[model samples]
Target: MNILFIEDDMIESMKFQRTLSKIASRHTIIEAKNGEQAIDALKNSESLPDIILLDLNMPRMSGIEFLQILKADEQYKYIPTIILTTSENRADLLECYRIGIAGYVIKPLKYEDYEQKLTAVLAYWQTNELVKA
Candidate 1:
């Protein structure tokens, strides 16, 4: 799987990356610091990511803003996006769902828990694909 992660916090991003690596060693993970960089990464990529993990509070462009832009574009509209943020507020969660995000995951500080979340997300994708088939 090709995963695009848009997170502004460098340390947090690296930690998630490490957890993901352990969970799915063969998966290709790409990092983008903010929404603007995420858009650029999408634009420059030869292939679209299977899933995008976005953080709500980011510099340049916020995750909600990115979700709007991506959902508006036909080429990217179908790509699954999951909100991965430290925010657990109801408003943020509702807003992300309103913008058509596939899932909303709260950022876990523990590496083991993060891995579990990643595994669950991957499983959800697989289950969805099976249903579609």
Candidate 2:
């Protein structure tokens, strides 16, 4: 599977990469520093990602803004987007659901907990059939 991981924090991004490498070695991950960069990656990529792991807080554009733009577009709307954020805000959760996110996962403070959550998420998605286009 291919995943587009959008995050602004370098340390968090590195941590995620390390954890993901341990869990889903077969999956390919593409990194984007912000929502704008994520959009550019989508536009320029030869193939769209199977899923997107998005962070809510980013420098240029927030995750909600990115989702709004993505879900509005016909070509990208069907791709599964999951919120992998540190925020547990009710409003953020509600808005992400309203915008059509596949799942909302809070980034756990502990490395082990974070890895477990990511493992579960990946396992679930790996079993589901995704739109090839």
What lDDT does each candidate get?
A: 0.85, 0.92
Please provide, for model 2 over 1-133, each residue's C-alpha lDDT reduced to its tens digit, 9 standing for 90 to 100.
8999999999888888788778735888899999999999999999999999999999889999999999999999999999999898999999999999999999989989988999999888887877343
Q: Give the range of the ten consecutive residues with the poorest summed lDDT in model 1.
A: 124-133
Best by lDDT: 2
Model 1 lDDT per residue over 36-110, tens place: 898999999998888888899998898999999999999998889988888989998998898899899997878
TM-score of 1: 0.90
Worst 10 residues of 2 by lDDT: 124-133
Question: How displaced is residue 2 in candidate 2, in Å?
Answer: 0.6
Winning candidate number (TM-score): 2
Which stretches of candidate 1 lie above 4 Å from their native place? 130-133
Query: For each candidate, what TM-score against the reference?
Result: 0.90, 0.95
